[model samples]
Target: MGLLKFIAVGAAIGYGINYITKKGPNGRSILDDITEDAPEWFNKAKTYATEKVEEVVQQARPNSGY
Candidate 1:
């Protein structure tokens, strides 16, 4: 009984999150908005941001070695 209740709660939360994040008006997934049609500037900005995050992660790592 307890296990069933826990499973029910987990399923409810999962469904709620999935429902809440479904996009609305002018909304689109990151991949959809950023793919083929997005401007070059946006793509460059994304690349720069990704590089910055990677650099920060590297700096935080111990030696960041293989």
Candidate 2:
């Protein structure tokens, strides 16, 4: 039963992806827009993550008398 459920869930996800990515009369897909902007989105996420990590590290470090 669990295996069947897993397979059904996988099929549903696959169908959803296909539906979203299928181009309409305009010949453009959601996937196309996503691919085009993925790089910029990735860069923004990376910068945000780096800044968060730096903030956490700064908080973790013991401050010396300056």
- The candidate maximizing lDDT is 2
| Model 2: how far residue 26 lies from native, Å | 3.1
Report how far off residue 57 is in candidate 2 (Å).
1.1
| Lowest lDDT 10-residue stretch of candidate 1 | 28-37
User: Any residue pairs clashing in model 2, and if so which?
Assistant: none
Q: Which ranges of candidate 1 are over 4 A from the true structure?
A: 28-66
Candidate 1: tens digits of C-alpha lDDT, residues 1-66? 999999999999998767666665768644455464668878889999999998888889958483
Q: Candidate 1 — which pairs collide?
A: none
Tens digit of per-residue lDDT, candidate 2, span 1-66: 999999999999999999889998889998898899999999999999999998888788859522
Q: Give the TM-score of candidate 2.
A: 0.70
Q: What is the lDDT of residue 4 in candidate 2?
A: 100
Candidate 2 stretches with Cα past 4 Å from truth are 1-7
